[model samples]
Target: MGHAPVMTWTVRRAGPGDVGELARINCESWQHSARGVVPDVLLDRMLPESYLNGWRRWVRLPDPDGVFVAEDEAGRLGSYCTVAEARDDDDIHADLRTGELIGVHADPLHMGTGAGRAVHDAALDHLAEQGFRYAVLWVLKDDWTTRSFYAHHGWRHDGATKDHAAGDQRVPVVRYGRFLNARKRNRPPSGFRFPAFG
Candidate 1:
């Protein structure tokens, strides 16, 4: 087999103007990357135009939550990453120091070209900068390719599982976690809370 093509890209915080392209990329990546993992019924509903408004709203959200995109030298965006503080008050740790890797999706044409990695790394850096001590992500249990990708990057399955809603279906997903910045653990002062990202 031919070697996987090498790809070069730079990551940056997403802006209002990027919503359209980011929406397109999100829908396209889901259609391609989640093909066999997510139920066909759900994947079939992923349409670029339908995602534009959602992308617009998401990109406008404040810090602690972030959206980033990877662009090649030619100015074409190849992937995007979204992150925030972990939302689950049950199951996953939902504290000031815990964050979530909401998603990292790449254009099908850039799947093996390193675009995903660039944005993924940048998302983690953003979380660390926000003072997150740990990060978690959820992936379809059957998406071996994606699970392996996270594993290669030092994430470990954290023995948590949930039935995530995918359209009308509930599909099993596993959680993976990694330490963004390992340090002695200390409790936040009573009544202390990080500013809400929502």
Candidate 2:
């Protein structure tokens, strides 16, 4: 049998009109990726309709450019990611300027079509452009596939962990972080002294 044709996708800022498609992609991704990991009862509730309101808030923001969607040439939305200021007070880099990659999901059907990575890259770029010096995201601890994906993209565990509320149950999750725009620090003159030492 012949191999499946390669697919290309374009990444763009999501708008109010794209909320429906984004919801569908989100549900489909959760259903497909969380099959064995999440309880079937809980996964069954991951319906597209259940995500509409939440997606609407993201896409309808005054500046929705922080939310990105990837569309295939066939005009189908296959993936999306939302990025914004870090929300959790316990974020690893609490004292530093940081951004959060709220979520990133790709339709199972578009797994190998670059849809996921396209939106992923777009989110990071947007965060950097918004002047975030660091970025963070949470992922299920047992989700090796996703952990690998983020690691491959320069994210590190940062040794932070938390429990995510999935329906009535809680799953252990870990935080990943990366520097969005790191620069070398300039050293003081040859013999600069600290105020305490001086």
Candidate 3:
């Protein structure tokens, strides 16, 4: 019923029923990422419930699109990802190459076991299928793991950074973008390399 183990997995279009697992993973990812700024007590109290309500609310939002959980051969959830349409001045950027990776998390219990890759592959496939050519996600400047992850996954920097409002504080985040329509070798010339540990 929950995330466990499997060889290959399935990724479906997420719906209302997915709120619970989605919430769980979201909270787990956030709680892990928001180490000091978010107090332990506050995270413990707010994360799970916030995830539940937030997923529910987002699922009901207009034109709100996202993929479902990646279920293993054992019929359990492994990982989850969501792609949101991005609004930008560049039509190419906004249309084929400009979606936002909103949430991507694997069950901590199942972390580093290919579940994350499965979810990522499924989400990218979904984006390509939907005619998206560019995609982006925000990552904390201080979080090397996630930054390294996106870099390893073929995402490149657009040379853009932002100070976004998170809770009661400002967080420095980097923007990682992928050009779906470009040649596979046409990546940003940052000369950055991140080893995919998975």
Per-residue lDDT of candidate 1, residues 1-198 (tens digit): 565697889899999889888988888888887788788888888788888888888998898999999999998999999999888865345444788998889888888889888888899988889988778899989888889978877787877798989888888999887767532232234575522322
What shift in Å separates residue 8 of candidate 3 from its native position after superposition? Answer: 3.0
User: In lDDT terms, how accurate is model 3?
Assistant: 0.67
TM-score of 1: 0.87
Could you say which candidate leads in lDDT? 1
| Local distance difference test, candidate 1 | 0.81
lDDT of 2 by residue, 1-198 (tens): 443355788899998889888888888888888777778899888788888898888777654148898988787888889898887766636444678888789888777667778888888888777777677799988888888878877787877788899999998999887777641221222453211110
Cα lDDT tens digits, model 3, 67-123, are 657877776776788777764443225223456776578777776667777777777
Q: Pick by TM-score: which candidate is best?
A: 1
Per-prediction CA RMSD (Å): 5.5, 5.9, 6.5
TM-score, every prediction: 0.87, 0.86, 0.77
Report lDDT (CA) for all predictions.
Answer: 0.81, 0.77, 0.67
TM-score comparison, 1 vs 2, better candidate: 1
The order by descending lDDT is 1, 2, 3
By summed lDDT, the worst window of 10 consecutive residues in model 1 runs over 181-190
Name the weakest run of 10 consecutive residues (lDDT summed) in model 2. Answer: 189-198
- Candidate 2, superposed: residue stretches over 4 Å from native: 1-6, 63-65, 92-95, 182-198
